[model samples]
Target: MPKLTFNIFPKEAHHGDESVWSNLIGGPSSFSLESRIFHSISICLMGISCFYIPYNLYAGLYVASFSAFIFGIFFFHQYYNSRFNARKHNNTVFGLIGLLIFGVNYFANSGIHGSTDLIWPAYLLLVFAITPYRQHLKWLTGYLVFFIIVHGLEFYYPELVKYPFLEGEGQFVDRISTFPIPLVVVYITIKFIRQSYDREKKAAEERAIAVEISKQQILIQKQQLEDSNSEKNKLMSIMSHDLRTPLINIQSYLELLNASEVDDEERPVLERALLTSTNNAVEMLSSLLHWSKSQLEGPSVHLAEINLLRSLQVTLDMETAHAAKKEIIVSYQIPADIIVKADLDMLQLVVRNLIANAVKFTPKGGLIHVIGEVLAQECKITVTDNGSGIPVDKQDKIFSIKAEPAIG
Candidate 1:
């Protein structure tokens, strides 16, 4: 535990075929799955022949011994070419060799009652595993015909058949020894197939998860874009109406003065009105500049120490003048020593909007009161007026980009 535990299987969750185990069986990244299977089975066959060669020799079955030796050499050569040189084993050569050797072994052994018949099916299975799908029908049909012709020859000419096994004991030994060949072939082939299937399933699942995450990110980006567009539209609407109306008021006042339409008491009244419009226009223009800057270079918060009463007094004074036009009484209650950390422009914008809203909603002769108070560690500001209140159904979800800005 202290030192090392080598990861023989590095990419287990969703690994490619370039693992160490994969490379040992077949050339990694270069070989197909079928080629890997071919190499694996060839290696197993080579080992099986090592046992068979000696066993056949001891049993005095020289032809069987020779066949086993040949099988070992053929497979060893194939394994070397495939695993070491990264060469594809010749399927056609391998299939033809199997047919020739087995045909000879059938007659040399006890024809129709020998282990050659037992090994035939396993060999055919190996051929199909290694070869392409299109060649399957060709090999199967050819093997079937060969098998039929051999048995038919034995039926017609009994003298041509060899009886190499002396009795039950001899036949039993041959069958038992030959049993391992098919068993090993089936075991390795099925195991490799199952492993390949599991790897594919795991890779598909990971791809699905990645796709889902990408889809979620796209959805979040879409929501953010929609919110930004809505904010842009709101700013444009405010600038067109608020800033333009005040400038138009100043223009009209100048026109009236130039025409000699205002005189004495009326001139003072017109000057006061003109001053109010100019101030409102300047404030609106300043807010518009901040909005434009934020649009050009994304919104950023700048928090600083602010003298709360002193900063908001200007906004309150402006609101009071607007309220006087409607005969609505406007007043405020704020501690002079109340200092805060906040963005000055944003703080003033929110307060001004709130006071303006209250002035708009309050009836003639109504009282609009602005109050600033300390609540524990935080500061709270409220603009209240004797006006029609929000409905219970509408109060829970009050603010939205789609909702009207003013309600009276």
Candidate 2:
């Protein structure tokens, strides 16, 4: 004898919010959408047949045996399709089973005037639930036309549909036994629909959040690129102004030398003036190059201890000579022993620009002062001149990018 196995309740392993059944069957045959519905319907039919077979045997063994065979075929079809085919054939299989078995059962039980009338509509509901929406009209039209033909046959040929029982009691038992099948179908169908809806809604919400995050990241990247371009433009503007000033002085001196006659004594002085302008241009070019490299690759700072006076000595001497032509008094008060931690090139360029700006603004014979003070743990450097002071209204903007160079 072959052993028989029966598993009415589904067993599944849980992974996060999903189960093994959802992973395996949810693609082609979703548990909440298709497989679960088919399984419930299959089990309901088999369970009903357990009671249906014995009851119909008393009425007639031929009817009971045929019902059993139909039930067996439906059970195996659902089982095989659910496991191997993943319920891909659910709509066609269940539609055929519902149409053929319920149609024949209607006449076999008692033709058009039986409990099959109550069960037929419920079976149709199962077919509608399992099948795709496109097949609805086709199946409904087929079932309705078949129903009309069966009724017409009963009216014209009364002998075709057999009445299994002759009285009220047999009819009562048959009707009561068939009631549970339709009820179970309705309950499971509703459950599967609700579960499928919830799953899809959750997936939609996750996708929406992911899209919002991507949009925010794109906005941040756009802002960063705009800032980078703005900084590059500002640096280029300042470089143009500073670089042009020294080159203009060099070109003016060269033109003057070409146009004018010079004695031996005056020629050396003009050459020294030209040499000073050339050195200023070279210093400005070096600063511009360093600034450009920093902007390109980001700033790399190396700090070391150095005497502040020693570092500024060459810069101060150069500015004094440059200012001597205008008769401006340039003086400094930094101690020879005063030391500070700084990047040497950056510190030298900063000091040179301050003095140069002072020389550019001061009138002939104006006094300029350079002072450095060490207080507690801080070193303060100040550049002051007796040139026209910045106006009160413009003082706040003196350090801003909009601080334009004024004509002396």
Candidate maximizing lDDT? 1
Write the residue-wise lDDT of candidate 2 on 283-375 in tens digits.
768867786668656546768999999888767876776677689999999988888998876777678778877888889999899999899
Q: Model 2, residue 352: displacement in angstroms?
A: 4.3
Clashing pairs in 1: none
The lDDT of model 1 is 0.79
How does each model score on lDDT?
0.79, 0.73
Instruction: Report the C-alpha lDDT of model 1 over 181-201, residue by residue, as the tens digit.
Output: 998888878887787888889
